[model samples]
Target: MTVATHPLVARARLLADDLLAPHAERVDQAGVPVSHVEAVKRSGLLGVGAPAEYGGAAAPAAVARRTAEILAGACCSTWFVTTQHYTPVKLLAASGLPVRERLLRPLASGELLAGIAYAHVRAFPRVPVRAVPERGGWRFDGTVPWYTGWGLNDVMLLAGVTDAAEVVFAFAEAREQPGLRPSPPMRLAALTASRTVSLRLEGLWLPGKAVVLRTPQKEFAVVDRPRNTNASPAVFGVADAALALLDGVPEAEETARSLRTRLDETRERAYALWDHPVPHERIEERLALKTRSYDLMRAATTAAVVAGGGRSLDLDSRAQRLFREGMFLLVQGQTAEVRRAHLGHLGD
Candidate 1:
């Protein structure tokens, strides 16, 4: 579907313009205001991937990606916070568990927003979090180095590795509880308004019904590699936003257009490889495209900063924000293997 016709695209764009863009600088310094999140919930974009049966849009992947691009380009912090909801929605839809029936409707309807603490699953051998069998449930013990949307999210999808090297994910109350303690929201160089914190899980327990997915570590990695290798649409979104800042400057405008064209071409190819049903095929090619996209993103944001001159150094300026955002995108989905391949591309 065309971006204009897509159910959530127009709404996302409206939110980006009316809410996200206006308060972006304030949010950057003060943290995402609850009112902004309320706006997002009221907009109904949260359910872009939810099943239609539950009053969700359930739009196609391409439409979802475009909507994400719009939101990310408009305001990365808002995008980062709300985007966490989609993963749990997808996980619940795939689980076929009773919890899906209980949670999916409200989550889709925006009655409850969800955040994720499962990225630590990628730290398998390191065992960042460990899950132990307990009475009628599992006890999770460890530290979550990065947990975003702390005060805002109603529920979280938390995962820990078991002794048998299986990863177990369970739904938990997002607020502080006896075993779940969140550090004061961190002061970060970027996306600080997303309200990220380090979570210390001290024997946190969730009953059997709370558990969502449990599988061998090897099996999990098999599924994760392809997903992580794909280029994030946000990278292009941020770059596009930066290029727009250069539009009034004639010299930079021409350069920005060239970079934008190359960015779009590489984005198309990267998404093609990402959507390929065969996960591992053309992996090196995917990494190459991803690296190429990063290069363009850097160039685009740098151009915007250069064009903005003295004003660009202001913390509240759009140019500076986009540049900082570009730095974040570089490591957003990075894995060691992806990092190595990306570095190799730089040498070429």
Candidate 2:
């Protein structure tokens, strides 16, 4: 089936139009509610990229990206919370470890929602969390500077660096356990509804059965760098949403159309590269397209705010929320390489 007609894509559209978009502004201000998350779980979106055998759809990558765009465009806050589930689902699907059998089915079926605490692993040489072999398992100590969907997620795929220069990823309940303490949710310029917090991992221990993937730091970076270089579909989604806000503003019609044209062209080019067989083949081109997407996202959100005038500053204004969310996306999933490339692009 075409990506547009894919059942998952249709469900995402239905979720966006009937529920997410209608309450987006409220969700932004009040935080994503449990009801919204329940709806998502019931919608079967949590398993989009999971293996079909595990009660998942295992849809194509294009379909997955399209669904993300739809949800993010409709309600970025809800999208942020649910988006965390995909990583754990993906990792478990690829793993041969015991945890795979235990968690993959529940995760893939949307019966359990998982969050991720591994972004800190990107720091490499300065590991924020450490996993030392101990007691037939491993001990994790140090801090996870950021953990999103704290109260909402059922489990977390936590990661840490070992002295042997390897990255160890494991699963644990996402709660205040003996050694995993979480700070209160952070207040942010955007997506505060996602319930983000810092995790203090003081001697947190997990059995070997909980471990999923263990790979050399360098090897992990090799796979990770290319993925980060590609533009996120959510960027295009949010940009499009911002551009749509200009529809009612007659004075901004010309500007909106021009930005839309540029957005469409950039999105086309970005997706073309996304579909390239060799992910690592065109590194520079990927980074360039990513930065370009960011540029378009910024311009679109800013134009939305400008077109809204002072009313956009209101807490309930969709334009203002998109503006803040745009700021948040600028740094989401950012790595040192991405930062350097983006800054260099800006300077150029």
Candidate 3:
């Protein structure tokens, strides 16, 4: 379906034009208001990747990616806060556990927003969080270095590494619980409006049913690698928004056109590798595209800032915001392998 006609895509554009874009500066400065999240919930974009059997739209991957691009371009903060919901939805949909019956429908229907606390899984050999078997359940201890949408999410998919070298992913209420506490939201260089914080899990316990996915660490790595190598759609979204800001400036028009062409080419290659059915195929190509996209994003945002001149430094200016957002996207889904590969590409 075309983006202009797809219900979800149309809703995203509506949100961008009517709500997100108009107040994005204020929202970025003051923080993502509950109203923004409520609007997202009402739009039903949270179910983009969820199974249709559970009341989800389950739109095509291209549509979902484009919707994300629209939302990110309009307001990265709102996108940051709401984007966390999809991971948990995907996990629960594929989990085949009893908790899926209890949580999937509400999550899929946008009745219960979810967030993620699973990035630490990428910190291999470090084991930032540990899970131990306890009274027919599991106990998580250690810290989640970064937990976004702290107060905004109703539930979270918390993950920890087990002593046996397996990874355990489980769901829990996002709020403070018996052994879980959240630091006040962090003051970040960008996307502070997302209400991000660090979580301390001290013997956080969950029944067996709460556990969703349990697999060997090696197996988890095998699954995670391909995902990380691909470019994030947000990179292109922010870049596109910046380019739009330079549309009429003769000095920037040529640069914007050049970067847009490169961005489109890189995105095509990245998505091809990402959508390839053959696992582990073209991984280097994916990483190369990801790094190239980052370069284009930086160029696009810098050009916008230059076109805006001193005015771009204003906190209310979209140029400055998009610049910072680009910086955030650079490291958003970072992994050591991704980092090394990105650095190699930069050196090239």
Candidate 4:
């Protein structure tokens, strides 16, 4: 089914099939799937959250989860890039009125694609692109990394640090800026087709209603809360992918049981951390919960992928994705050993 013809959730799956799966190899070598990203925009999934006033479906988590899972299965890196910055983009939507009018419609209509500039120097940068505070705007400069979907994005939802070192969301048009280089292409172990890279924004401008986001919710939330924006989708989708790999395997039942159990426990921890009425005694305790959740997700996925008799390792087969996908779990935030230490400290 075409994304346009089906329900939002159905459309999300269709997008994965019609858009990402078919062009997996092409995107792999082409560096960035500019066309594929456009397909996402055209699919109107990007507009799923913006209000109807600003031209969007304002879809729920179920819809987002479905699209994320499917797209991730086909192309892990691209999904990572698209999803990692979701929370920031949503924050911009809360900017209200003029911000929504100027930015939201374009975001929904594919006239604009929003991307996140993360991992810039590993420590957050406080320098502005053009922070002169003249003409009712801020002049800024500096290079940022992990600005996923760089060349294709029309708007940038940046977390810029002020002179006082307070972080704020600077929403602005990306193209007109003279100093921002859209970043060169790079290769990754998995999700290689996501077209993620570093951006060099030198002497840029931020003005009008596009101001820094000051929401305490976004600010205070831990990096891995409800799972990192990237990891949540990757974990769920990779699990789905692994299960798909199990279709013909003799160990399908066993692998599924373990995978489901892990996913359930992870979900419980996520809900507890986010939904509980009380605050965790220590920040690391909460962080450890997230870390363990990630570990379980990885274990289940690896177990499922490798269970299929190593036949998936065939050069042209989908099974090759399993092993490499396992590698992604290793790099997200805290390691297993670190989590153990946190747990040990808590016990002590």
Superposition error at 73 for model 4 (Å) = 2.4
Q: Which regions of candidate 3 deviate over 4 angstroms?
A: none
Per-residue lDDT for 1-348 in model 1, tens only? 686787688898889988898878888888888898889998899998888999688887887888888888888998999999998998898987778888889899898999999888887799999999899899999999999899999999999999899999889989999899999988877888889999999989899899888989999898888877888889989988998998879878679879989998998898888778898788888888888889999999999999999999999899899898888888876789888988888898
Clashing pairs in 3: none
List model 4 lDDT by residue over 212-281, tens digit each.
Answer: 4543323534432334322355556666666666666665677676767777666556545544454433
The lDDT values for all models are 0.88, 0.93, 0.91, 0.59
Predicted candidate 3 versus true structure: per-residue lDDT over 93-160, tens digit per residue = 88888899999999999999999999998887889999999999999999999999887899999999
Which parts of model 4 have CA positions greater than 4 angstroms off?
Answer: 1-6, 118-135, 175-177, 212-231, 268-289, 308-315, 329-348
Clashing pairs in 1: none
TM-score of each: 0.97, 0.98, 0.97, 0.76
The superposed Cα distance between candidate 2 and the true structure at residue 196, in angstroms, equals 0.4
